[model samples]
Target: MRDLLKISARYGLIGSALIIIMFLVFYFSDENPLQELQMFDLFIIPIFVFFGVKEFRDRYNGELLKYWEGMTTGTIIALLIAGITALFLYLFVGWIDTSLLPEHIEILLGNLEETRDKIVEEMGADSYIESYEKVKGTTLRDIVIDSFAKKIIIGFLITSVVAVVLKRKELKPKS
Candidate 1:
């Protein structure tokens, strides 16, 4: 557990820093931070999850990693990464630049319009519009929840796959 915490903390910091750097890249560029393509940047979390578990096996566990050990390490990495992301989100929206969020929400609404049109056409005007309005009204708190919730959920799935791949049982000698 001690090794897991130490390894996860370091990897989690790297994952979180990458997210913030990605945000800054978008925030500075002409591109909208809320752009759908930015979802690709989320690949960092899984990468770190794999690294954390792998390091635990290689550096501390004597080249033997049980399925549960890898899974737990991955989970710890996810939790730490998600928490750091949420904290940075609060800072980004609440302090670093509050105005960026309103603009981001506007972009979110603009992008949603085309999808909303299709949804309305398929389902009904009123139902889609109502949901669209709700989405457009999203607050910074909502963004915080959304950003962390998305990472945590996806992180768990990635951790599961990584754990399965990385798990290696110890070989025992016949007595």
Candidate 2:
């Protein structure tokens, strides 16, 4: 267990740092921080988790990995990355540049309006109004929670597939 956490922490910090750097780059470049480019996280989490689990199996576990071990390692890394990124987002939007929250909300609302017809047709007028209100009332706390939740959910799904692909059992030697 100690080895699990140690390796996970090391890789987790690296992943988190990379994500934070990406956010900074987006922010400084005047690009919308909540843009579709954020999807890059889908790739980042899996890569780091894969390497982290692989390291544990190769360096510490005699080249054998269990599904649960891989899952646990990936989960821990995900938690660290998600928690740190969410905190950074909270600070950046809540304190660093308060204007960003409102700007993001406006952008979301504008996009929502652009797709009003489609949303209404698919979900009905009530659903469309609910979505509009939800976007309009979004807060920094909501953003942080949303970001954290998304990372965790995506991380778990990716970890599931990774664990399956990497899981191995110890082979028995001839008696």
Predicted model with the maximum TM-score: 2
Q: Encode model 2's per-residue lDDT on 13-61: one tens digit a residue.
A: 9999998888888889997676643697888988998899999988988
lDDT tens per residue, model 1, 62-102 = 88888888878888888887888788878866897878677
Q: Identify the runs in model 1 with alpha carbons over 4 angstroms from their true place.
A: 36-41
| Cα misplacement distance, residue 105 of candidate 1 (Å) | 1.9
Model 2, residue pairs in steric clash: none
Q: Cα miss at 103, model 2 (Å)? A: 1.0
Lowest lDDT 10-residue stretch of candidate 2: 31-40
- At residue 162, candidate 1 shows an lDDT of 90
Task: List per-prediction Cα lDDT, in the order shown.
Answer: 0.80, 0.88
